[model samples]
Target: MKVNVDLRLKDIPGQLVAALEPISKYDGNIRGVVHHHDDRVGGRITVNVIFEVRSEQSLDKILSTWKEGEVDIAKIDAFFETYPIQYLLVGSITSKELESITKGLEAMENVASIEIRYTGTANSSSRAALVTGKASKKETLTTLESFFKQRADKHNYMLIRGLD
Candidate 1:
């Protein structure tokens, strides 16, 4: 599994190293690290670390160690191996409808992540939204297609598969 850990560390010497030690101690293979020194919130710097762990148990251990080390974890995002699918929605897309659709997709059991890109004036009835989602299984992909199709039909939108 790939995990992204968002950390806020105090602006003290060795604070960054202290925060990262727990990941290595718990055997998390470090993939990338984005240390943002310029961005600070209340004397703390934001650090985004991406790593891979063998199992859920390993992730738990690493998080526990972070707590023990007094590392402030802002957020954690996890990703599993997934198949990607894209859909283009055109015609009469309101922000509320798009939000509803995205939320609905995210709430599904097999969906891992969703990214939406909308293009058109807010006041225009004709709009386009490009949506991408990651699914873990073949059945889930079929379900996703059905879900989107239903939404498009209900909202009178033209649904286009794949992005040009």
Candidate 2:
């Protein structure tokens, strides 16, 4: 079975290896590991690890090993990537705030560009943010939403996620 395990870990060094080491021991073959740095969500570093393995038992063991030391499974899903994922952020967005959001994504690895639409107050939450990330479609979607959610909550914005 192919399982997608999403884990949130600390931003400090070596946490990535710590999370991956256990998976191999449990006969989990990593398909893709999307490691990202999220400034929001209490600044917890997030990783969307995609693995192909057999049996729920092996997955459970790996999960148990990683369920501590500030490591958490945000989601465990069965995922497949066709291509890249796209997101739209529509709300009252200031240029400066949007710039910060872009910078935050840039600070993480694989975030390519943030092309914003600048809708200019079409509604109560009527601004647009177009972000492109070099992450697996599912991981990119998850990571982007998590970041947007924190920024929106802090600054009162609404985000919508879908295909471009």
- Highest TM-score, which number? 1
Which stretch of 10 consecutive residues in model 1 shows the poorest summed lDDT?
133-142
Model 2: what TM-score? 0.45
> What number of clashing residue pairs does each candidate have, in the order they appear?
0, 1
lDDT of 2 by residue, 32-109 (tens): 988676523677767888897666788778878886545777888864333354566667778888779878877755
Query: Candidate 2, clashing residue pairs?
Result: 91-127
Quote the positional error of residue 55 for candidate 1 in Å: 0.4
Residue 54 error, candidate 2, Å: 1.5
CA lDDT of every candidate: 0.85, 0.71
